[model samples]
Target: MFRSRTKDGQAVTKVTEAEPQQIRDPQAPKGRPTPKRSDALAQRRTLAKPPANRKEAAKRAREARRADMQRQRQALAGGDERYLPARDQGPVRRYARDFVDAKWSVAEFFLPIAVLILILSIVPSPQFKNIAFVMWIGVIATIVIDSFAMSFRLKKGLAERFPDENRRGAVFYAFMRTLQMRRMRLPKPQVARGERP
Candidate 1:
């Protein structure tokens, strides 16, 4: 502010605070559009500053992917449905998993049995190979029968529990779960073997 001397030897001045400018970021939206809950959470959780260059942007992307993978891994081990894949989501899927995990299945042992048979067949003797072949066939038959039986039971249980719910792919989902050893099951078993789901 400046005061100027007038012809009358008096100083007159008008003083007022300067108004601040409302600076808006060109890249920022005027209003945020609605986003999915998960998308919103992810957006809110990102770094405050934007990447300055292509290299930085790529690095950020890699970090985000790694974090996502870590969360998924934790979810699989802890059975957090929020972080689980689409294939394992929903009440019907959860019930199927619980049902399958609550009981033992011959299919779960297929991996170990197959390895044993493979080693047996590696021997030079023809008889050894024949025995291995027979064992393999038996294991295959047992796994198939066990899977079918489990699917039937799962279908019935699903019908009773989730009659009007989407049960599509549930039997297959349960069947895949049955193939994994109880110790290795993704979304680690919520129910212990022989424990009623």
Candidate 2:
């Protein structure tokens, strides 16, 4: 082994000539050892109990799903925005809904009129039948024209308001909402008729 003289004049062995000492790794796992395979299997087996009957298991599962849906609907209705469905959660969609809900449209009356027309068409009176026929044509024509106009305005508004947003289905969504009677709109109207968005 080579020796080197230190500044104090005493000879010291070079670090390269000394044997290295073992050092423990700081990241090494410590504490309780892993369980045996049999022990692990036993633990897993005990964690969950199997249902005794298929019908009971199914009923329990159905109840769980029902509860989940109810919670989701409540969250949406309460405007807990985080829990809203993918299509309805974003600011652009919310704005579109508000825009449509704020205005009055012929399409908004479509559902009730369509139902009335169906009832009128089935009546025994020829007068009712003729009225229903004329009404149906008028309703269809009015809805078609109004839907076009609503969709055009809605698309333009969404573009102006949310230029960075992906508005792929926003127009269709607004159009569908317009087709429903105002009072029956889901996630019910936040703004009253004639209110500005």
Scored by lDDT, the top model is 1
- Model 2's number of clashes is 0
Number of backbone collisions per candidate, in order? 0, 0
Off by over 4 Å in 1: 1-47
Per-residue CA lDDT of model 2 for 1-197, tens digit only, reads 56989999999976563667668897898644789999899767744766678987897688778878886797667655666777788888888899899988898888788889999989999999999999999988988988888888888888898898898888888888888887777767888888888
Tens-place lDDT digits, model 1, residues 1-197: 56888999999875547844578898988554669999878777666678889999999999889999998999899888888888888999899999999998998898999899999999999999999999999999988988888888889888998889989999998898888998988989998889877
Looking at model 2, report the run of 10 residues with the lowest lDDT sum: 13-22
Instruction: Report how far off residue 70 is in candidate 1 (Å).
Output: 1.4
Model 2, position 33: C-alpha lDDT score: 78
Q: Global CA lDDT of candidate 1, please? A: 0.88
Local distance difference test values of all predictions, in order: 0.88, 0.83
